[model samples]
Target: MPASLSVETAAPLASAADRLRQIAASTVRPDLLGRIDAASRTLADATVRVVVVGQFKQGKSSLVNALVAADVCPVDDIVATAVPTEVRWGQQVSAALVTTLTEDARTIRTPIAPDQLRRLVTERSGAPGAIGTLHAEVTLPRAALAGGLVLVDTPGVGRGNARAATNLTLLPDADAIVMVSDATQELTDPELRFLQQAAALCGRVTFVLSKHDLQHQWRSIHDADREHLADADVDARIIPTSAFLHSVALRDQTPGSRERSGIDQLAAHLQGPVRADVVTQRQLAAAEEIVAVGRLLAMVAQSELDVLLDPASGGVVVHDLERAQKTAEQLTQRSARWQQTLADGVEELIADVDFDLRDRLRKVGREAERLIDSSDPGRSWEQIGAWLADSVTQAVSDNFVWAHERSLHLAGVVADHFSLDGRAALPELSLAGTDQALRAVGGLDFIGSGRLGIGKKLMIGLKGSYGGVLMFGLMTSLAGMALVNPLSLAAGLVVGTFAYRQDAQTRLDGRRAEAKAAVRRLIDEAIFQVGKEARDRSISSKRVLREHFVGVGESFKQSLAESVRLAKRGADMPKPERQLRVERLTADLAELRALCEQAASFSTAHASVALRSAS
Candidate 1:
């Protein structure tokens, strides 16, 4: 069965979402409506992302091809995947290249030949000045992808530091991850750390031991991997697989071949349990949101009923209304404590970030000086320059990531201070554009030595020799000796050598100063660029939270006013009219209560069905 059973299940989910929106609109609860709309899209699309990740040459691409039952991902031993490739369902095989260079660029669906896919996705294929592709998207008709299952083949880890960082970035967005490892070795330290992180970011993870046919001790490796995972307190399933065996079995039509390959079992697990769980989780989330909105509606209706039925309740209700209105007014004021806290916190954060950046650059400067002093700058300037550039870039990237994370943490703290509901959603904090800023800062230039020219060195040496000869010859002449004496000759040689050494030391000091100045310039540029971005993000967060709370305050005030108005109107009516009005209100509340019950029941029933299917 398709994971979501879209045809059978989508209608009810959509209907419930729409009904919630309608209720929200009628009640003037735009916040509730927005939440429903977001949940509705998740239920409608039902995308389950299963990312395939592993070390270099572990047959990750081949495994992806086999799982999808199509050769969508390019597999090569020489050059690994430089960009991620996503495989999804389509009526025909098609491909497109996605680049992160421009926002307005359209993705032209081009017909890519099977042989050319490797070229398009690999970094070695791009022209000297051409833009690199971020990732590739390929779609083909496959039963495994029928239920909106998207399989992403990511770049191999351990290939490069940047590649590993990119892979880590992908984890937060993955619904499930399939980590591939070779049977030849137990999990490496980096791979184990990755698994631990994946377990944290994504709730569902599976380990695949690939190339089982290549190793005779595949089972031992698998058992060792399981033990390692258990020691790390990460619960995950480890399945041994051989792409070669699976392909040969299919081609030869051998009996029990599919079972031996383990591809069939893997496919069954993905298409059945994994798919069902994703769908059920989304369904439950949407159902719960609907129930929350329903409860809000019920609460409002009951308040009105209470006000209309009890004569003495009017004074109490009016007093509560006045108090709520005051609270709402305070939320919009500049003097609000949460607003003040946010402003002060952001200011302090900016100062701290600036100080930290300067301190890092100072350390880099000290290290660069030591390196320059240890060797002749002219002899090893190129290597030292390259090392400095790489180190600076890494430092800048790390700082930017830290700033991004801190900004998010600060936003949460601000939200808490405002007493925002736990379920309130915030926009995704993205530092995607920071890479461009880093690039703009460019690499460090080689700070050449300020040593004197050969002519100047000779002049300085000559001057020192003349001074020594003059002084020694005068002293020797007083002792009744000639001006051109052995004592003057020896003294001239010693003085000239000392002068040359001193000149060289001065040049070295100048070069070190220049290098330190260059490093400082780079750090300053990074701070200007990255710090600007951080400040903008913090300000934007503050604005968003302010507006969200303001909306909440307004909604509360409106609800309270509506209750008070109904109460006042009912009290002014004649006895018979008041009774009729009460009866109508009662009926309306009953209808709303029933709808709320139905929404909850629908959610419960679907959850049970999903659980049964998963089992």
Candidate 2:
């Protein structure tokens, strides 16, 4: 179950926002009005998405069902999930299947009964219309989901499975990922690798050991899994759960059973710590917006106050504002240093990202060839193939993470160029779309069958032995009395054994070489495909940053121009009217000060909360 922001936390932020909103309305200042309104709307509409992913038949769907206390995601023993299902809060229970038709390739979403979910989201034998289903959306009126906690149940990761690639696409948007595994065993190497990758991508990962009731040694396994996490340096909390126990607890109203199930603790942790992070981030963002608006508001009020207090000073104030206005207006100009910094940074970033990806893929190729040389690919080809795919996936993911970080760094550099005071809020860069960019690249295709069948091996052995027998046995027969004598037969037999061994070695060598070539091809293809998409995304990011900062600059210019107008107008008023205007300005400044204090206070409270949680 997902947790919503606590009422205690939400109340104060909402109160501060309401105050800010009233001020926006009263001031009728366009800059303050729009920023406040947008911040408030973003806060109200914020949702935290927690995506659950795991290997096949790991009870991922069951865990989701238990959390929501509803069968929103279909589960079965044999068939596994083939599509992602999103479970979020709704007033009524409803489900829809999203699919794309083959002919027109147009996406169509159709409403379906909850019971139809099992058929619609499963493999092969699924319902007729579920053929091209992309994903399923399920909504319920569960209290756990009411707080904007969206639970996405994704297809499991499995060997040579297309679902693994599909699951990778969801990593970008996930606020958190719950990697589910059953209590039957500790985390496997692949699962541990995935946890590392998930942590890198989403920054928040929770490992859940499910089916706790069935495994007597699950507790021991849980401890072992913790050790594995420590060894891998993957910071994730592993919770052991029993969906069976959860279901029973729900039916029997047994608190003890629920407690033992660990579901309650899982829910609390998500709602408390996990949900707190999301809320805190939003709180701080809204606060920043509110504080910025406050500053702008106070600026307007202060300029008018100066004009109202001293008519002689009004001209000086307006002149200063006009100068500031010119600088701000230049921020939006094409020749601005920030724009130049952004353009240069983007080009540099693109080159670095391309180089980084190529370097990574080259390493993957080398590792692939090394593995091929180390083992007989004929017997280990499938494992090698899976490893290659996973390795490439990892390399690509790491590259994307690096690119995302660099993009943020570039934004900061641009911000530094724009900020006169060396402090400016870097607008959020839209770098999460790299997942979509990678999604365009296909998974590695399986290379040649390394297995040379017994028949072919025997044939090669016989072909090689035919010449060996004639040469060795004839030479031996010359030393003996007859061609079919014991010495001749022994010579042929020994030669045949030698021929089989040599032929087998030759075949193994050929397969290894073939495997190496295929792996290199795959790596090259990945680099080309992934590199192009990454550059495209980089260009897109550049455009977004350019537009965003330009807008910010324009806003600043507008605010300054308006402030100048207010000061000039105030200077022309009569003495009595000037006094009244000063009083009004004084009151607005006081309100703005209070709002800013509230923002600071909220940040302090959350900071303390975070510290305590960490401790």
Candidate 3:
């Protein structure tokens, strides 16, 4: 179904290390391969087989059917061949086709046509302009047993719609590729671009310019396509002929065409022994993927096993379960600033309003009754108190709306400038911070909501002694029924406004500090992981590459020494020495003769082995 599943259960017919072992077994050049793989494996996936791809009208289905002598992919639709498809084999067994992708698949079914395929691709993949999917097996006793030479028929590269692009990204897992451009139009820009880029994946490439029957008279078209490929240094076959034309003409009636069955010859070449080595290497690589995946699974978390097996950043470790407690603590500490900033913003609202509601209310209460001097002083005061209460209520309602609006305006202003990393996001924080700000201005009501009594509210919220802080709101009320002369409500308003400003400023500062600390902690952890991984991968890649090179060097040394020894001649010999005057000369001659032959063979095998291993 998924590639992840393929990797997990594959049992990697070979491990990464086993790929080396397999190479040692499969090498045609034992001297070179043994040197290459003895110390460690490298290049296990040695072949790059390419699937010739394009739109329905682009001759993809035709080309593949012709090559394999079987109709492998469906070719009957004008508009809908979009879903991703796969075709795997099980030797010459002729097992049924199995189509799969994210649980939408058909098993034991024949291939589907392009129009039918459109439904599968669009409805299932959620990709635009999708065609139905097809995944069939072409198992002939002769086919699967052909090592690993698989030539797939893919949807168009650039011609397919967006839906096509999403599903068809997987077609080029080939040892080499042969891009088929229609011979009539020749090498169009779209066709040329796809070929140029696909070549990077596998250097082995050939260009097939099909549709030659219509353009046979136009020899210039064939010459042009050939020249383009050659100029790009693309060592690919540029064949200009139609599969249908070739197939039909080869029938008994077309005498001269009988000699040239284009499709038949292409199949024979692809099925030859030349492909054996490439197929073996691909098999080895597939085996290696299976083994490596298995080894890592035992250690991953059961819930996260799929993620670890996933191909994209699969090995990345985010938060481990063990870190939950510490991470929670960090989050809790971090959120305090959010609450604090809002409260600070509320204080700012109160300060910037200019008219403190409490003080203004107090002035209204006193001014309305300041004209009263009663014959019954106490009773007169009672009458004045009733009138003042009404006056204060009316004045507070009317005047305070402006103050409230000012507060709302200031909150929005500050919030608009907030950022998460630089400053808090003002719009969101201002919205979220509203409740905290209201509690700050709500006098006794605000204190009760926070699990703090009026006394504690004064202490924590006012940041002052209980008596002085508690007197601010309560004093305004007392001044309206004064035992003394009227109080300075404006002065009190100014003082209270300052307190609100200070609180807003303090909260903003705290929030900024908290957010910065969070970023710093995250960055520090990332840096540590990067450093550890850098050191580890560096050591691993180097160890793997070095041992491989050393083994190659040792093999080279042995080869060179062996060559020297073989060059030595038994037919020729050095002159013999005499005695007396030649006594000294005779002694030297004996020593020289003894070493000459040995020098030619001295540890040459071991030397070559050492040279390859080191090199």
Candidate 4:
């Protein structure tokens, strides 16, 4: 019942969305606005995804089942969840198999018998083909699922690289993460690492210590885990739970058993703060959208109001509109100040990125050289190569991320140059394509593999020994000693060792040079690719702003023309008729102004609430 009733908690958000829809319809088309329709749909759908993730055999599935009061996810000691399982509210029990036909290009949903869910989700069943199933969505008429809460059971961490990647990728979309771990052990290193990444991506995470009933020392374990999380600087709440106990309590309807199981507290937290925050964010976003629409409407109304209240203001309005039109035209000119700023900014950005990359590679080269001087290249080259690849990848990602942030910041600067009042909202810029460009530069394959066959090492050693014998044996011959004498042998031994060391150092230096060259090539390629993208995005942003202002100028002109027509008509009308028309317009203006104030108040109130919650 709590779950069914939770849907009512989002009434404020729903009302806000409806109010925004009405405002958008009267002013701008709802479909024309970005993020408004999407926010509205989110409010309407009311789905909050809480993904349950953990290591294999950590009782994640059992925990999810207890939370939802449904045996939707398959649980076993040996077999594990291969595909994600989504459990949501439905009138009757039903299930669907969602299959991906092409990564994300297409998907096919097929209705399946609920009994087939376990087999399809398990790796042992092998139900998924080569192009595996994406996930299975199961629907049930449970109270917890009634408020549009979708519980996701993801494959455990530490399964494999593919599974780990999938888990990490899912974090960005999850509204909250319930990290399940057994009470028998403290958090492992890998789990801590995963938590750090998940915290970065999701922002809201809760640690669930499972199997509390089995582990008599769960309290100690929970405290230790809390300490561990604190030391690791992970800000998350930890709740100890016993899924088996919770399940029993639900089945038996035992008094106080629910509270003892700790599932009730977890559920309440999810239904209360988690759900409230989701709704509040959506409400605030919708309020902003409404306010944006109201601003535009108010601008038009104010123009009319000004003319009616003071007929002399009509000329001033027209002049302002004409000036706005001229400014919009200038925005498109190549010689505009903003265009020049963009050109200069991009040139500086490219130089900074190139310099930063080269500097990073130089450091890596120095480290590699130090290691080469200490050991044979064939022995430790693999480690050096791996380190270089990781370092370069991280450096490239950082540079690209920095470029993206800078590009957006620069776009704002350009917007300021175009704005007559210097307060106009800049068009939102998207540099998402730049990320793909950085990835296209590929990994450090040019660094070459460190795996050197024994045959190559042997040949190098033999060549060094041959040189040592030829040079040292001749020196000994000058001392009147046989070529095979002990003196010749001793000289050859020392020379051979020195030659071997020299050869290794030379090869190592050569490889290091090659690695540096490869890194430089990659950096240049990235600069060409990412620099072009930044330039294109800059141009695109300018065009978008230009078009937006151009539209605004047209709207202002039309409003002024209509105002002139109305004023002329009023001058010719009878006094009583003109008075009535003026009164009607006055009332409409008052109502529009009130609506604008209300939208602004909504934003302010929501913002205050958010600040309080954050604090």
Off by over 4 Å in 4: 1-45, 99-104, 124-133, 231-233, 252-257, 328-581, 610-615
Query: Model 1 clash pairs?
Result: none
Over 4 Å off in model 2, which ranges? 1-12, 22-31, 45-48, 98-108, 125-133, 158-175, 201-204, 231-235, 251-255, 418-423, 429-493, 612-615
* Ranking, TM-score, top scorer first: 2, 1, 4, 3
- Model 2, global lDDT: 0.78
For residues 120-219, write the lDDT of model 1, one tens digit per residue.
8765654211242266788889888887889999877653224334555566577789999999999977677667766766678888999998999989
lDDT per residue, candidate 4, 1-615, as tens digits? Answer: 123223443565456446545644654443324435765675565678898888888998988888888788898889899778889899999999886653343788989899887788888755342453367899889898888788899887663223333455465567888898899899987688677767766777889998888888889999999998998899888888888888888789885777778888888888777776666555555555555544554455555556556655667765665565565556556676766776787667666656665565566556656665565455555665556554444444345445545656766776566344323444544333333344445554344444558897677666666766777778888988766767666666677677777876677677666665555565566556655654554556556655554443344344344444454444455656656656866775676566556655756766665676578
Best by lDDT: 2
Question: Could you estimate the TM-score for every candidate?
Answer: 0.71, 0.86, 0.36, 0.65
- Distance from true location, Cα of 203 in model 4, Å: 2.3
Q: On residues 120-190, what C-alpha lDDT tens digit does candidate 3 reach at each position?
A: 43233343321233343444444532544566655554421322332123422455565766656767655
Alpha-carbon local distance difference test for all models: 0.70, 0.78, 0.40, 0.65
Candidate 1 Cα deviation (angstroms), residue 5: 14
6 in model 3: Cα distance from truth in Å? 29
Task: Note the clash tally of each candidate.
Answer: 0, 0, 43, 0
